[model samples]
Target: MNGDWLLRGRDGRLTVYLKSDDAVLCRAELAPGGPWEPFRRIGGDLGLQQGPAAVGQGDDGYAHLVSWRQAGTGESRLVHSTHFRPLLAPLDWSPVGHPNGRGDRTGTPAVAVDDRRRAYVFVRNAGGGVSLLVQKERGGWYPWRDLKGSSIQDQLAAASRESGLVEVYAATPERILHWRQEEPGRTPTRDETADVAARPGTLRALRTSAERTTLFFTDQGGELCAWRPGGKPVPLLQAAGPGPVAAVRCEIDGHDCTVLAQRSASGRVAFAAYPTEQEQAGAWWTESGPPLPPAAEIALAVDAHGTLVAATLDPTDATLRVTRRKAEAGLALEGWREV
Candidate 1:
């Protein structure tokens, strides 16, 4: 993973960044049928501490972002921004679950949002252990709950607004673990576990439909794997050579789903697909280019009618690339030259 792009969602619109090491609340938008907008500091200029950011929408339909700023004493402050404005003069978020506590020493803390607009943060706890904490919808942190395993190479969690269930995917010593809120107001339950040849990290999930949920993860081998509930997991095409596989969901065409995976080191990318229940069941993937240059990052958004809008790093010149596909074309991409 590049570790440069941070994911954020607000008012059903998602924004990400390719370069955030310098800008605060740095974000880029993929306009419909338009080129990617340049990186602009959306929220106001935050002083010294710039990174460890996350974005999401609230029940009130406003966009929100939370960033961890480093203090001079090496402590961290949690800054919350609502609708692109910082709130409460920057809360001192030194602790993993509170302001007085301390967190992981080396890694940047991560945050996520649930359907109810609540945010959860995953970080190393005060006990020198990695764990997750629930930030209630009303804006208070909960107790730090230890994750199942010790080393969380990467942790990702999302809440489905449609199902009202929170899903958390983590990498542990044993395998790739998936946890979902079993019922409303109840703690999440481990729904499934899959053995990973590579300590699976870099996971992404898409609940395209109420009955369909898909997950993408990069194993220890740096290869990509797509897990579909009740179906055999599909292996994504890895760029030839040694590197991490970056994959993002593009769109859903009827029974066919599309995803774009980029090989970082080689800058090669492949547009892959999997058949739904109405279609055949098997691990079938197709590629586009001859493993050309790599892009900075990839972003995918599907419209209500199932139309796909893919925003990715252009291989030829390293600019932004966008592609749209309707259901009738069979997703057989053509003329994907750099624009």
Candidate 2:
């Protein structure tokens, strides 16, 4: 799982989905780091291109998940499911539905819920164009609507503000595109940001507030860069290795910021913080954390109380380990405990 895979549900409960050997497994913690429920197999006999993407604890108290199901021949399609009550026993999941018709080669789907509690799913289709589907406030999903574009290099990232404004982003070989829908039924607007390197990596967007969104991706040189709506790309950190970079909106001390975590070539995970606004240039990035066990990729999420959780697969044993950091701990890597 990549961007925002972990979701916070009722009572500070957290839900995450991962691709195990043969199925998509889901588990929930009553709180940030304790007494996790037994793994529940949600889908089986399946091929998953990426882990599940989810929107948690909507106004109706349901968590929605979307993922691509690949057939044995390698063709992919989109399927969705919902958890009616995420914090209860005998966890009830709605029947899986094929929302986007059959036989479409799609990337991992991205989901965002607006202030009105309407849910939207975004994905890059086989033709390289993006498609969107909406879940009505009453119930049920609309047919997939094509939002045309070409040569999208990776999966889409989406975030919504309290004002009901939804922003979605994707990268092409030459530039990154941003799409905005001011309100649910209004026409969406599109624009391209500065030109970027023509390589494939994660394209992530965070809505730090109603007024701003920050985009993060790996440039051609493998260095991590950040771009605001109309600003130039700012290189934040040098590339330590080749893999997906995971980020989440968080707050440290008295500052609201984006926290980034990535694995180096040697498999050690490092983190840095980029303040929403900085008074000094060099003060923007905090020191990198010490190396951890070798990991192929890292997934990040912030709990309800603002504790940062970092999850990765242990290289030696392939088991998922989750670690949490409180805001008071600053950037130290010393308090991580496996969940």
lDDT of 1 by residue, 1-339 (tens): 122132333323334443355334333445323343444564455542433454444334344455556644766555554443112122222323333355323333454456666665554344434455666667566765665544555444343435555565655665666666656545666677777644433656555556455666666655566776556556664433343333334444444454544444445444556553222343333444444453345555553344655455532344555555644656654445443
Q: Residue 26 lDDT in model 1? A: 37
Top-TM-score structure, candidate number: 2
C-alpha local distance difference test of each model: 0.48, 0.64
Q: Number of the top candidate by lDDT?
A: 2
Rate residue 225 of model 2 by lDDT: 76
Per-candidate TM-score against the hidden true structure: 0.70, 0.82
TM-score of 1: 0.70
lDDT of 2: 0.64
**How much is the lDDT of residue 161 in candidate 2?**
57
lDDT of 1: 0.48
